[model samples]
Target: MATFVIVGAGLAGAKAAQTLREEGFDGEVVLIGAEEERPYERPPLSKGYLQGRSEREKIFVHPPYWYADQEIDLRLGVTVTGIALDAHEVALDDGSRMSYDKLLITTGASPRTLPGQAYTLRTVADSEALKAGFAAGGRVVIIGAGWIGLESAAAAREAGCEVTVVEPAPTPLHRVLGPELGEVFAHVHRRHGVDLRLGVSAEEVEADGVRLGTGERLPADLVVAGVGAAPNVNLAREAGLEVGDGILTDAALRTSHPDVYAAGDVAESYHPLYGRRLRVEHWANALNGGPAAARSMLGQEVVYDRVPYFYTDQFDLGMEFSGDTRGYDQVVIRGEELEFIAYWLREGRVIAGMNVNVWDVVDDIQRLIRSGGPLPPQD
Candidate 1:
């Protein structure tokens, strides 16, 4: 039997193992993880789970016994020290070696750290630590207006804590959503008793609060820095694999080495839809990319093409989006700003669409984007 070794047992790695079994590979599968816990989905880590509205069991991608039942060797709390392609083996931290006919890397990404009294959320342990701070209704001063920061702000407020979000940008999500739509989020957070401070950053994270760049100090019992994440590409880079921003892979998810494959947040896969390469770090990408990488590993002719999809829920807003926002010439807004759909158009063709507080339109929006034709003018 062909032995397949999978590094990093996140959602992508777990799903890939499941796919291998379902596809009747009948191979000896090994799943390894640095984290001691079972593979779990991360979206809830910053949302439901952190908000005390979700249980730990609900976060797991698969129950504990599922791996044993599937006849897969699941190794938890282990680290891969080195990958030896010439020998078709991996050196482990435990001084053991694992050989594989095929190897998959789903190492994922790590949260960017700040040099201060600040916390970042990445693993369940991180969430648990933050949850303890929220239990006391502590004052939270979050640095960064990105998705993680905004979501953490909303969750902290939900926990009866005083929340203040400080961003260097003019508005929340300004870089991704642009200033106009970013203001919408700014208004929502401010309306919900959140002190949304724009165009400022913490000069230093003090013991009791944050000192702003403009010489203002905000009291904070808990400090969170959700600046961003960096792809865990050191392993691939060390192995002499092509890496740029992330581990470089083709549309089918194959890496520079034929026997080596990558998926999820760490894999910079070529997107046929955009005719370029992008490394997407979202729940949808991990959930879908896992199986795609598996199919390609099985020597099946495949092109991993799927419309990028992501959603977020904060306060009373629930939004979903499809397509890429690159090279868009115009943004068309339909309905009111708060409860509306925004379409990014390039040369009269829809390139991306986002809906906020709107339901049952993602399918149609995706169709229009894929159609790459003119959309009806907003009434």
Candidate 2:
């Protein structure tokens, strides 16, 4: 039987393994992960799990016995220290080597840490620590105004902590949502009693809290860092594979190296729609990209052209967005009773859509993007 080696046991690695089996590869599949725990869903870590609405067991992507039943050799807590591309083997931290005919690098990303006693939410342990800190919080300082930072702030506020968000940008999500929608987010957060500080950089983080560059010190019992994430591309780079913002891959998700592939947050693959390279970190990308990469590895010529989609649940609001908003010419808003959807049009085509408290229109908007049509006007 052929041997396949997969590094990382996150969503991408797990899904790729399952896909290989489903495709009847019948190969010696070995999955190595640095984390001791089994693969679990991460989206809930910031929302449901943080709020105590979901149990630990419920967050798992698969049951413990599922790997054994699938005949997968899951080596948890085993980190791949090095890769020998010429030898087609991976060096483990335990001084063991695993050989493979094909390799999949799905190491994913690590949270960017800030100075001082602050925590970044990327793993189950991170969430656990944050939850414990939140339970005993007086004032919480969040360093960033991105999606994760905002979500953490909302959760902290709901836990009865005085939350303060500090961002160097002019407004929250200014780079992603632009200044317009970012203002709406700032308003929402402020309305919920959050101290939304924009255009201010955190000069330093101390035992007491965060100090702004403007000589303002925000007191805090706990500090949460949601700055950003850096892709884990060290292994791929060491293996002589091309690495840019992430592991550079073709449209088929194949790396520059032969018979090696990458996917999920770690892979920067060519996007058919945008005609450029993109590294997406959303749940939809992880779930869909895995199968697409697997099929490509199995010699099926396929291009992953799905619209990037993600949803954020902030308090009572359900915010869903699809497609890229990079070059949109205009935004069209459709407002109803308690439901609103915004469509981003670029050159008469719907490039992206954002829905706030409107769940029903999300699918239709995505379909409209897939089908291609003249976008509706903004009210």
Candidate 3:
């Protein structure tokens, strides 16, 4: 039987292995992970799990016994040290090597850190620590007003902690939602009693608090740095694969090497619809990309052109975003005050849409984006 070796057993890797078996691959499937825990979904870590709304068992991609019953070799607590592309083998940190007829790399990203002991939410343990700190209900100073920062702020506030969010941008999600819609998020957090210090930087992360660029110090009991995350591409880079913002892959999710494939946060794969390379780091990508890569590995024709999708639940506001924001010059807001459908248009063509406090419209939003047409006039 042909052996398929999968590295970095996150949601993508776990799902890929599951897909292989479901597709009748009957091959020697080995899923390896550096983390001791079995593959689990990460969205809960920053959302429900962190907020104590979700139980720990809900995060796992599969039940603990699923792997053994599926007849898959699941290797936990071991890291893939290196890959010998010429030999089609991967060396493990445990001083063992495994050969594969096909290989899939699903190594995810790591949370960017600050100099001090500021916390970042990426793994289950990280969320557990943050949850405990928030439960204590003291003061929380989060640097960076991105999704993670804002979400954590909401959780902290719900836990009765004094929360302060510092952002260098003019609004919370300026880079993603742009300034206009970004202000809406800022308004929500501010209204919920979050201290939003916009247009400033966290100069220093001290033990007691954070020092602002304008020479202001905010005392805090816990500090969180949600700056961003960088894809773990060192393994792919060292293995002489094409690497840029992430590992370069074709529309079929095949890497530079024929036998190697990449997906999830680490694959900057070509989008047939967008006509460009896109590296999406959202949970939806891992949930879908893994199976796509698995199908492609099985020599099936695949075009991984699914529209990017992600959602957030914070405070009383729940939101879902679909499509890409690239080249969108105009945003049409159909409603206001958290009950709205915001459409991003580029030269009168819809490119992306976000629905806030709205439900069951993602499919329609994605359809409109794929249509690449003007927003339909309401009757």
lDDT of 1 by residue, 150-188 (tens): 999999998899999999999998877777678889999
Q: What is the Cα-based TM-score of model 3?
A: 0.98
Off by over 4 Å in 3: 374-379
TM-score between candidate 2 and the true structure: 0.96
lDDT of 2: 0.87
Q: In model 2, state the lDDT of residue 95.
A: 93
Using TM-score as the measure, the top candidate is 3
Tell me each candidate's TM-score: 0.97, 0.96, 0.98
lDDT of 2 by residue, 1-379 (tens): 7898889888888998899899998879898889999988789899999988889999887899999999999999999989888898999998988888988888999999986888899999999988888888799999999989998988899888899999999899887877767777888889899998899999999999899999989988899899999999999898789999999998899999878999999999999777899999888888888878877878888788888999998876779989888888877777853368878788888888889896777778888777666755642
Over 215-298, each residue of candidate 3 has an lDDT whose tens digit, in order, gives 999999999999999999999999999999999999999999999999999999999878899999999999999999999999
> Candidate 2 — which residues are off by over 4 angstroms?
336-338, 371-379
Instruction: Tell me the deviation in Å of residue 104 in model 1.
Output: 0.8
lDDT of 1 at 72: 91
Model 1 stretches with alpha carbons more than 4 Å out: 376-379
- Candidate 1 residue pairs that clash: none
